[model samples]
Target: MTPRRVTVVGAGVIGLSVAHELARAGDRVTVVADRTAADSVSAVAAAVWFPYRAGASPSMPRWLARSLIRFAELAEDPGTGVDLREGTVVERAPGADRSWTAAVPAAREALPAELPPGALSGVRATVPVITGSQYLPWLAARCAALGVGFSPRTVPAVDELAGSADLVVVAAGLRSGELLDDDSLFPVRGQVVRVANPGITDWLTDDEHPEGLTYVVARRADVVCGGVAEVGSWELAVDPAVEASILARTAALVPALAGQPVLSRAVGLRPGRESIRLEHVPGDAVPVIACYGHGGAGVTLSWGCAEAVADLAGAGLAGAG
Candidate 1:
């Protein structure tokens, strides 16, 4: 098929991945965002692919599975920077409702006698951990090689993009409201702290964290410790109190990380909705499709979503013809 001119809003990992998929579909692609690809939330994330951590809602598990498989395929590309990793998600202990890992227990494994008294209570399933610092820019380069154009601009209004492209996709994440009137969408603020890990390379338990402690693996630099899931909180400034709490909790979870050099702290606002939105923006001109409000599963769901968008758009175009 001859390439169709297409414009994508937001150059974060999600937008970049969508552009890459579209370009491969032979569509001329343009990506626009407020910051460079490296400065987006995707870059800050541990970049692992675990969609179920957010729960199985919105068919997210299946979507994540598709994205993970697609990511693996892309990783096979000689130059693509995506990395596929095998990891574990330990359920140190189960709760009354078993809200944590009930949906995904790898199976009951005998707690290692070597495991400190609290090393872990039970075993949950394991999944992969992805590092996005390398992955996001790699996707950007992939899109470029496939004839996708990059734009360093923000769309302050839907009309700005809706009027300019043959087709547009809103992937602005939490900032989508600037151009999209999605009342159901808002920010779920998350804060992560990176610590230097000299020899630590495996997934370590984040301890008995009840509310916020989770493990994140980053790129060449080090691992990430977090974090808080502040709902509707969009403050980007690092909260000193929250930062201290995260560090303390992470150390407790993985004592090996105790006393490690502290690298930096980051804050991000995940786009969240009643349901992860993946439908056409009804009133936007030029047949706009939405793929935002992924909450924390944005990276995990990327490829699956790109495939869906490309498929739906391709189908829509064919139906119109």
Candidate 2:
């Protein structure tokens, strides 16, 4: 029997991951995208394992847990651009959601010294931190090794692939809802500044920072300092004022980075929706697996979402067979 032909839309971490999982499952996978991982919002992400700005989903726990496990496994190989690092999630309020802790068994309440100034509480855990510049290309190479093909082109519609593809997986980030005509989708704008790493290895996130959402993530090459989550904003240009504020905030969080040379600045519009859509589209001429709307947790949730998409594709293929 000929292997099933699967066309995946988008080449970000999520799309590449879905392609890898499906191809590994013996499908003929082809990834179609206008932006590869390096140009996609995934590249702009601090790429930590924390679930930031992801809306509620019934499968969130499972997805987070599975992704954490996969990233931990990937970290064993440095070439994969994944690292297991310790971090603190600074809490400003007493009743902040601790639901994510269920997925991270090693998570524990931080000591007073671990907490930043004025922090009400904090959680410390060692989690995966992905360096996208390295991880994206590595993922694409791994997918190619698994016999997955890539097409550098725009996919205007999912219907266009119905004739040649046995199944279509839509992972098109911000453009997914437009392709599928789902108006519930929106863009959550995020901005970050990359600075020279001053030998910092640990990461810190202050979601409840009085000024804005602040985080400091140390990668192998550079330290990522950010950010601001602007809802319903689509502007991609870097804002000078925002950048200054980010620099100041991050400096206060990690003093060593105060005088560090600026490396780069980036702005990305994260695909936001009420919840992630990862299911079969009903009544379509072709079998379509909808797997987009990851928001800021795209990297945090990629592998788990990919596995779920693969499972859906497998079930769909078996039914068709």
Candidate 3:
């Protein structure tokens, strides 16, 4: 098979995963982005593998299943910063959807004793918890080893790369809609506080909390506690009030967080849309594939989406030939 020159626009987990897969499939890939992986929204992710904020779609199940298998495989390599940790999702309501359990291994209903106060039900499972500080760089290094190239430029439109490459992939996160001329995309702002790890390894998420979306993810170096999901919010400024609330909620959930030293604070605007955009656009100067709008599940759905993107690009290249 002849190598196609594919230009991917985005450097976040989604784009990097797509680039890695395409390069592995013998495509000559170049990634263009305004922000490096270290500065992208993906870097701010607590990055647990559970699906969050991804709207209902039939395809979501398959994407999640594929990603679960891939992340589990990656966990075998310690250098990848992916670890399978036992965790629980507490639900204040009894009818919360447990459909996500289908993709999770060893998933089971938590016992009454396992449920936190005021929680009606819970699910315990082992899922991949990624430390983005370590994992993002690992992903980029893997891409580089696969011969994928990188360009630190912001593409205003997909047509801008038409003359340079045979194909283009739009995985530009929140800015993806700008180039695609789709106005349905918006931001779901999230804020997280990183604190010194007190040797706690278990992870917990209480999205149904009356206060806000709260979670505690203990990674190798630091414990990530957060957060708030403000839909349609574009603000990136860190609110001291939000940080204080996060600390209070997290410490209540896991007492070990009490008095933990502050490591850092971060804010990320999750690319929120009605559903994930993973389709080929026909009316472009070059064949363009759109793959963004993952919301908070970008890391959770990345591998599956990337594999699908590579297959789509391959089919397009074959059709062109």
How much lDDT does each candidate structure score? Answer: 0.70, 0.93, 0.93
**Candidate 2 C-alpha lDDT tens digits along 1-321:** 889899999999999999999999999999999988999999999989988878999999999999999999999999999999999999999899989999899899999999889999999999999999999999999999999999999987888888989889999998998778888889999999999998999999999899999999999999999999999998999999999999999999899999899999999999998899999997666789999999999999999999999988878766565
Candidates sorted by TM-score, best first? 2, 3, 1
* TM-score, one value per model: 0.86, 0.99, 0.98
The weakest ten consecutive residues by lDDT in model 2 span 312-321
Candidate 3 structure quality by residue, lDDT tens digits, 22-96? 999999999999999999999999989988987767889999999999999999999999999998999997689
Clashing residue pairs found in predicted model 2: none
- What lDDT score is found at residue 111 in candidate 2? 99
Candidate 2 structure, TM-score to reference: 0.99
Clashing pairs in 3: none
Please count the clashing residue pairs in each candidate, in the order shown: 4, 0, 0
Q: After superposition, how far is residue 198 of candidate 3 from its true place, in Å?
A: 0.6
Q: Which candidate would rank higher by lDDT, 1 or 2?
A: 2
In model 1, state the lDDT of residue 294.
79
lDDT of 3: 0.93
